[model samples]
Target: MTKSNFQILLADDDEDDCMFFKDALDELSLSATLKTVRNGVELMDFLENNLSNLPQVLFLDLNMPRKSGTECLLEIKESEKLRRLPVIIYSTSSNLEVMDMLYCKGAQYYIRKPADFADLKFVINRTISLLKEKNVQHPTREEFVIQT
Candidate 1:
């Protein structure tokens, strides 16, 4: 697919992580268009205002200033217009308890941010590939987290 074919949204407060994510995407040459929102508030605003062009998937960081990913997740899932949108929890923490909660709350997947650039690319690739499958849906507990 071309860059315009795959649209992705990322909501994270970390400047460095956003840069790293874009860099990994560049290195992979996967033709994915990524839009970054610094925090959950911005993410929600974008999502609400851009109803005509909703992203194919959202990569959300669990912690952010102003509003948290948990809050955003809840809001998104509660919205009839946004509930079907796939959300991938991209966070630094690997707290299984929190992950379980997020799953029950309706997030499609949880991905622990990879420290290595190559691993990050791999994880992103895997995620995009998996999402392309017709049968792709909320994963089982054992398959929820994308371990790169």
Candidate 2:
């Protein structure tokens, strides 16, 4: 995709993780504008910032300082306008219960974060590819008219 058509919402607290992801995204040559939120509260505030601006994809970390990603996902799923948006639970923990909970919370995918940098990059690449396929397989955007 062209840079003009790329956009992603990344909700993560760790700056290092974000930097690592940025490098991976660059390596993949994905033309995406990543919007970062440090915590769940910030993410919620962003959704309400502009009714017209909505991201096509959301990458949420399971743990955060103020609020949790699971809570954030629940809120997003509860919203009629946001339910259709693809949400991926990208977390460091490999806990089965957390994964199951995230799935039940309406996450399209639950991915365990890789330990090494190379593995993490690979995980990001695979997730991006899978999401691209899923988007094509089932196209459903909310009628709420959000910006790209």
Candidate 3:
């Protein structure tokens, strides 16, 4: 993916959170494309149908209506076609155990939803930077949880 055309897919059920994320991306002025899916089912369908053009990164929320992000992560990791996709767990829960579980489940990063808009921007920018620098490689446990 080109630096100016980063593709991002966000799976979130919360309308306000999704709006906030989009607003943050707009404010950052990064030449990125953002596509959002409201639930895990749609997320999976989108990924499956767009196999030839997968996003550069996926920001997935843990809680959803039909399917959970945890289930989606496991499915993605298990699928050969989608196994390499970079997934960043984006949720409000910062529980160490849950983070550890997600890391072990093959998530590239974990980001606790920031309450402040500035912090949200910072974390999002940092995440994009890391993706560019690391080439979507799985980071160490210590580096997995990104904090603002």
Model 1, span 4-92: residue lDDT tens: 67898999999999999999988876777889999888999999999888989899999999999999999999999999889999999
Best of the candidates, lDDT: 3
Candidate that scores best on TM-score:
3
Model 2: what TM-score?
Answer: 0.83
Name every residue pair that clashes in candidate 1.
none
**Clashes in each model (backbone N, CA, C under 3 Å)?**
0, 1, 0
Across 1-148, the per-residue lDDT of candidate 3 in tens digits comes to: 6868799999999999999999999889689999999999999999999999999999999999899999999999999999999999999997899999999999999999998999999999999999989988899999999998
At residue 34, candidate 2 shows an lDDT of: 83
Q: How are the candidates ranked when ordered by TM-score, highest leading?
A: 3, 1, 2
Each prediction's whole-model lDDT (CA): 0.90, 0.73, 0.95
Return the TM-score for candidate 3, rounded to 2 decimals: 0.98
lDDT of 3 at 108: 97
TM-score of 1: 0.95
User: Considering lDDT, where higher is better, how would the candidates rank from best to worst?
Assistant: 3, 1, 2
Off by over 4 Å in 2: 1-4, 136-148
Shift in Å, residue 135, candidate 2: 2.2
- In the range 61-103, model 2's lDDT, one tens digit per residue, is 9898788998888988899877777787778776766666666
Residue 45 C-alpha lDDT in model 1: 96
